[model samples]
Target: MSKNLIYLLGSGRSGTTLLATILNSTMQIHTLGELHQVYSYIKEKLKCSCGERLEDCDFWKHVLSKMELTQEDLSTLSQAQNYEEQHRFIPFVFLGKNASSDYSKSQEILFKALASEKSTWFLDSSKYIGRFLLLKQLKFLNVKGVYVIRDVRGVIHSFSKKVQTTRGPLNTILYYLLTNIFGQICAWLFKDVVKIKYEDLIENPEETLHKVYALIDQRYDEIIASDFVMPHIIGGNRLKSNKSIAIKKDFAWKKNISRPKQILYYILALPIMILNNYKV
Candidate 1:
């Protein structure tokens, strides 16, 4: 049986986590938050959304046992993954080049272990075009991508806020532009890709989810509020740990961001914003 994978692609802070969490409510759909960061999380001894250390998580323990991977093997896999998913290696990946055979084989093994008969589709909210391209090389897995985009102003405002890793206005604009450019290219290059706006998702979640379900060839059902639970997600927004799920539009950017800076962001992102039909 072929393994089915659905990847979320685009810049971060675009509500991919919320989208994935909502989709996880659907039967037979599993969300693996930022699967690309699994090795890093393990290395750093980070915690899963389930509130257990990654190395100690029952789910990851099972995955490790199934893959039969040792600590040393994980170290090697991490190095290979880093090299393969680097921004510089993207062109090579697109040109059908494999940076490391070991990485490719390990990824195949990992996904095989993750895919079970019970689950029809696995969602990876990695949000990177490079990782998405790398996964496409795994022919045993049927891969589809959702390019999730948010308004540039909103993204800028989110990044500008004081956080652990805050980005300046210029950096935020550049990151948004570069990621979306590659994301758009990937979406166009692949037939099994779809685009979703964060605004639409917040305003009409049921309708937005129906579109995502269609992309992954899943039948849609009205999402039940009680079905929302913190799954065995690896790394994502802190909201994943919350017991309650709230769907609301965050228009705080309009109020908090300075008018001058907003105008500058608007001008810088005008082209892509226009392409995405995002207005000021």
Candidate 2:
């Protein structure tokens, strides 16, 4: 019943991994990259950021063993009745309560093992709206949020570059709009929602992290920022593989995306953009 969870909520590719890396650099904080994407990691047979297959990675192997779970149990949660149920399955397993037939006793073991570890708080950069919604229902632990936002054009550009999908520009902008709207609603519904601009995080990390640390009641450490090593994060942007952190604003969308597309993104994301004080 401790304040165990600090979830970084946002759309994928919007710097969740970057934020997680910074938080994990601090004292008494440990971050697990993208818990919701565990099933995808297994199915795709993705390697951990440590360069070993996820199951073979020593860090995650320990986590899985302590959870009293196999890769199969973790994967099956994604196939649950719905995505929210999948999110709920995490806490259900953690509290040793079963909300699905797919669950096992690993949840309790994982919780106790993590508690015994030195980390006082855990970061879950799931970046999914449903995950945040479900996390709010857990009474045994404190659930706080960091809602990360980037310009819609930047997100679409990143997606277009990184993701293999062939989504159209309008569709991409609409999707970004909806995702931000969902994040805003979650922030509105939650108590300790800290809003972070992706640009500010990279351009002014120290000040941004200090604000975040204060909000979470943790002492800010200036040294942790410079020496951060990426943890054994699960599913997220591939940038996690970088050995060191660099804060660079990726504004290629300003030049790469056509002006009409930029205008379209602005039009679709206008209200939420204004709410976040984003310049259109």
Candidate 3:
């Protein structure tokens, strides 16, 4: 069976994790949240959504054992992955160049180990255009991209509240603009790509997922459930560990963000906002 890969392309806090989690509910789909961060998670002994440290998780242990990756190999692959993930390598990736053969090889091995006879579709919510572009160059897998967009105000608000280093409003807007601009370009470059709005996904999940499923030629099923088992994902938002999936839209930016910052985000993201049909 062919390995089918679905990559969610979007900036952080743009509902990629929510979409991935929802899609993971499908019997045939397996969610590998932020697969690119696997090395860091392993190195830091981060906790998986399954409530176990990555080094202790049976699922990850099985996958690492299957790939037969040694500690030295992990360190080498981490460096190679970091190299390929850099913004400079994007052009090379677009030209179908393998900047790091080790990264490519390890990706193949990791994905092969993740694939099973039952689950053919693997969802990687890495949200990096470089990774998406590089993965498209790989011939072993059938790759599809989903460009997820959210209202700039919401994104900026989310970024402001991030406990880790927060990208201030200006930086957040710039990052949002660049990511979605490139995301739009990615959609144009790949015929198998689909674009979905975060608002629409929350307001109308079944319809939105139907559009996503069409990209992979899969029949859409009613997979959203009240209780969801957190997949053995490596990196994603804290919500990944939550068992109950909520589809409620967050309008916090409307009240929480100051008027000036909101206006600034509106002004900075106006072009893409109009392109994506977002309202003030």
Candidate 4:
């Protein structure tokens, strides 16, 4: 492990990308977006936001080379039949372990190469609770967790509009409940876990990030916060393309999701929502 990995854990649409972009504003830290999807990168031949394919991007290519990852290794990682098995391999790769398994050795190279770079820290905003569990087994990483959460209604609203799925609203609400339930569990188990609210982030980025810095043992840099810039990110919300660093809460869910649906959401998410202290 690089001794500087900050893993962001949460469900999608919970502001992981937004927080990562904010952190990347610092020259001392580089935040890689959705790096957990490295297998997807290999499978889909996804293009980096910089317009070059992952294989061709200078930054990714360098990292891959340092990690000694080949197309074959990525394919093997992607081919893991069980989802839990796939996540179990994540921490070892970040630890730069040369384990017998290709998954562990490959990820170790990738993250170690990242640590070797100019930035003092690298933030992996993969947002998977399973990844957090896998990380617990590794001793090499100076790992800390930032559990980014948003209102369940807001997450459902965003997922409904942005994510194309056959799943219905009730299903969405159930998923929100379950994912967050596990996320909270991870936060409770992990040391130095920062339970951050997305609403808090947009309304008060400076204060929120200051708290995050404290969690990760990094000195808060005001200059970086003031003159924020989007660093080269791998895969995340399309909104990352927007150059403006303006921070504001997106409460569109309050107006977008009908009141009846909101009521239904509160009913379904009641247990976990109340557990997280989210208002009904």
Candidate 5:
């Protein structure tokens, strides 16, 4: 585990974060949220989830400036701070992009830190496979990845209501279709990759995560009771426009949104017909 990186790859609305949160609780497993900056770093004056600009937020500035912060530093800080503050250092929180990025240089900066950082497995819960592919090319061959999937209907629903993105309904659907399709293609392209259904994990978590953890070369003894049975719900946009890692019961995007949006989802998802045999 110490020699490898673990990535939870999926579309934006899928439940990659909760899985990362759970994995983060494991011994020597350091799970990072939305690390878009591994390829590029950006500074936005955007508001923090606490209604303050991220630039003005001392907590984030400290994290950004602090050189060589260890996994232990993140683990303790994340556990101690409010969820929003802890999440502030997330890659997306610091640097965000709607499209995939070329993070070769960023990977050099990040993985070098992780190699020496004290963690058995470094967890990445961003929903893009492009970054993973870029990292893979870096010759860091000992990497483990998970692809979490939610139904297309649910994903489009969540994307429509998001704050920072005001893409037209049609564009949202197209993005979902392309992302999922490319995601599946990447899953086929990568090694040591596993797939987890958001619904399956929610309905029968212990079994699903048992398999998930195993896929990443982690043992069951490392898991905690909190990871076993925590009822997760979703809410609150990132103070800086980010995606949720948890997909909760109330978040049935198909049931929650308007009919027009539903029709749009269907129309846009028509391309997914190629994956008719594909399981989500």
Candidate 6:
């Protein structure tokens, strides 16, 4: 079997989408946004940076069709559009909408059927390690996956923008510590896995993507040709995101993390950072 299927596994804000978009540009791949609706529905409502409703995209058009639903009946397909507020994990728990507690098995069937229908590549960017752990054991076993990791400081820095960093900072730091540690473990467990850093992917697109393409062994010309959503943010055209961002690099939320709070932030991150290194 050719390396026809590719999944982007990592936590949110770790540059999973950017890598996915580059793969979509690969020409041989027809990358879809996150398809964890089988395991998580949050992706169904989350808008791509491109600004289109994902369910309406051709990639999702193919995904939903195989699930035995149509555009007219999207409401009944999953609760993404309908459910306004939810814990992030609720949608991912696979609550028997398809009549089985084992969503991993059902997802594998959907994925295989999707592969059988076309020569396109599939990309899921939900960015959750728990989700990846569930799907890793499927029997189909022909998938080629990429694991995108960002510096933990970058992850905490990315989350400090919209929320209070009081406890949020610690939580974000812990999440980054936990998620990437899991990625490292998955690397040892799975054979078809490739790991890349988000900072490298964005700051040096061409060189890094060349490295990424080499790992997955996919051609890169067309993906490079297609327009990316955040060219400015990725290239040196913009400022770099701090290893741990208290404010968005765009300075879009400059007040979110103050210099004093940033001091506390670094202090908080130290133990978690040490824990990740020592425990891993």
Listed per candidate, the RMSD to the true structure in angstroms reads 1.7, 4.5, 1.8, 4.1, 9.6, 8.0
lDDT of 4 by residue, 5-116 (tens): 7788877788888888887886556777776676677568787767677778877877666666567866666554124435455455445533334445545655666745
Predicted candidate 3 versus true structure: per-residue lDDT over 1-280, tens digit per residue: 4578999998898999888888888766788889888877877788888889876787888877677778898889888887788777777777777646787786887777774764468889998889888777777778999999999999888888856457888888889988998899898877999999999998998899899888888788778565567778878887876876767788889999888777777878999988988876
> Model 1 reaches what TM-score against the true structure?
0.94
For candidate 6, lDDT tens digit of each residue in 94-198?
Answer: 341222333444454456546443455556665555455445545554466687776555666666555323236678766766666666666766777777766
Global lDDT of each candidate: 0.83, 0.70, 0.83, 0.71, 0.53, 0.51
TM-score of 2: 0.82
Q: Specify the highest-TM-score model's number.
A: 1
What is the full ranking by TM-score, best candidate first?
A: 1, 3, 4, 2, 5, 6
Model 3 scores worst on lDDT over the 10 consecutive residues at: 111-120
Q: List TM-scores for all candidates, in order.
A: 0.94, 0.82, 0.93, 0.84, 0.63, 0.62
Task: Give the runs in model 4 whose Cα sits over 4 Å from its true position.
Answer: 77-100, 115-119, 162-167, 223-227
lDDT by residue (106-217, candidate 2, tens digit) is 2234445454353377888877665565555555457778899888778878877744454566777777776777678767866688888888888888888887777678
lDDT accuracy of residue 8 in candidate 2: 86
Please list all clashing residue pairs in model 4, or write none if there are none: 1-95, 93-107, 93-108, 96-108
Count of backbone clashes for each model?
0, 1, 0, 4, 4, 7
Better of 3 and 5 by TM-score: 3
* Model 5: lDDT to the true structure: 0.53
Give a tens-digit lDDT track for model 1, residues 1-280. 7788899998988889889998888776788889888878877888888889866887887876677777898888888887778888788788887546878876777887774774478899988778888888777778999999999889878777775468887898999999999998988899899999999999998888888889877788876656577778987876777876777789899999888877888889888888988776
Point out the higher-scoring one by TM-score: 3 or 6. Answer: 3
Ranking by lDDT: 1, 3, 4, 2, 5, 6
Candidate 1 residue 13 Cα shift, in angstroms, is 0.9
